[model samples]
Structure formats: C-alpha cells, structure tokens
Target: LSSSMYEQIFDRTVSVKQRDREVSSFQLTYWINWHRNRHAPVRVLIREF
Candidate 1:
C-alpha cells in the first residue's frame, strides 16, 4: 500500500510537470505570433507608402 501511494504521488508530479511544459510551449508560440503580428502592420504600411 505504501508503494502504491508513492507511485500515485510520483504520477501526479509527472503529470503536473507535463502540464507546465505544455503551457509554457503554448505561451511561447502565442508570444511569437503576437510579436510577428505587432510588426506586420507597420511593415505593410511602410511598403504601401
């Protein structure tokens, strides 16, 4: 029973880390897209003028 409990705890910790990694990756992609979009309009306007 103690071993099983330990395993469960370990599994929960691993899942939490996995979730954190996924969230960070999602944030990174979002940041990159925002950065690109922020500059895209300026570039377009410069080209037009």
Candidate 2:
C-alpha cells in the first residue's frame, strides 16, 4: 500500500522529516477474552526508516 493508504488505515497523516532522514512507525492492538480473567490487549509496533 501507498503512503496515503497507510495514513488512512492508521488514522494519521504522514509527513517528511526535515533532517534528511525519514522514519515510519505503526502500532496494532488486539485481544482475545475467552478466559475468565481480564488482561491488557496485545500491542505491536513496527518501524522503518
């Protein structure tokens, strides 16, 4: 997917870095609540530069 698509899916706009470098990051969260106890949702972060 393109940058526009990434921005749309992540709900944020992407901007170019001004210091002659670029960085991209994303986060995803999910959970399964089939057990009896409550717990925090799993989260993952992806980064590319």
TM-score of each: 0.39, 0.23
Tens digits of lDDT, candidate 2, 1-49: 6644543433332222222243322221221221112322223112311
Best by lDDT: 1
Candidate 2: segments with Cα more than 4 A from true spot: 12-49
lDDT (tens digit, per residue) of candidate 1 on 1-49? 3644544554464356456756675664564356346443334223322
Candidate 1: global Cα-lDDT? 0.48
Residue pairs in candidate 2 whose N, alpha carbon or C atoms collide under 3 angstroms: none
Alpha carbon lDDT at 3, candidate 1:
48
In candidate 1, residue 41 scores what lDDT?
36
Clashing pairs in 1: none
- Please give the TM-score that candidate 2 achieves against the real structure: 0.23
